[model samples]
Target: EEWMALRIGPVVNLPINHLAELSSKLDPDFPVVAVCNSAYRSSLAVGILQRQGFQNVASLAGGSQAWIDAGLPVYGTETQATVSAAPQRHVHLAERISAADLSRLMQDLPGTFDLVDIRPPQAFAEYALPGSRNAEIADLLSNPGYLTGAGPLVIVDRDGSLAMMIAGILSQKTQRPIKALQGGLD
Candidate 1:
């Protein structure tokens, strides 16, 4: 499973090839269902399959997380729902500089902004945007000046969760504006 295998091995060891093989075995004209824990992985897999000529693939939206949320029963480790409240900083800062505006700033300001990738080291190793430096959220929170640049900070992750969390934290800690990538790298 992605949860366990990815933690202890290289990404090349993932079953992406196996999934491709299985997807190939299916009839392109017929419907196919792909699912995973939170739908993130399954959505990515389905997109890959579609790109590889599987026209009838569909990803289960919300995946097993939604299933569990509906009070459905399943055998195995229980899926605990961890809910969090939105941070006010994120709401306020967006008015100052929208994510789209930030992209323009990347071009306009050049070295004005700093890019931070606050994902697990494994995920960071697999895929990272250009000019991004891997910085753990905890470390960044503790050492704010570590990645300081001339202007505001822009943060991203595999999903936008960590980036958003860091943005909120940094915003509360310092007066500098923070923004998380509109959508994650996926």
Candidate 2:
């Protein structure tokens, strides 16, 4: 079934909410295997699918690592699959920046860039970079109006991961450049 292939349901980009929507469209009776670079995301995907009533959802244990280790033939294609579900424009910053870089950015505070705090409202109210706007990462989709107007956007979270997540979503929705604070507020 190499070319015929196991009809994998949805290979979500990075957003967890998209996984939930994809799960709803899947054939519940058919087996679905969630895969990612590693098992972490796939496991999370499985959990999401399960909660959404996907009974036969399974995560590829050990993910692509186990498949490569087992000598399973991997498919490679230059052509990208166009997922209508994917947001039109989004920049993903997978690498973390340094504290020094963050300090310099803050000191300079680029005029065209808007600093957004992606942490919880409580955390942001307690302490955050001065003048940073609050927008919880989890509520980005629910509140589409969070980011308004046009400008480069910077997201600050308690940690780099949450910032990255919010950055991806904002990048998609706003079609604007989104950056994450290198070390967050730490």
Q: The CA-based lDDT of model 1 is what?
A: 0.68
Q: lDDT tens digits, residues 1-186, model 1?
A: 544421211212225557776665656787766666777877888877888687787776787677667776544533468664755334334213345776677777777778888888898899886678998777888995943555778888766776786787677765566778866777
Give me candidate 2's TM-score against the actual structure.
0.45
* Global local distance difference test of model 2: 0.68
- Show where candidate 1 strays beyond 4 Å: 1-102, 146-149
Model 2, residue 54: distance off in Å is: 34
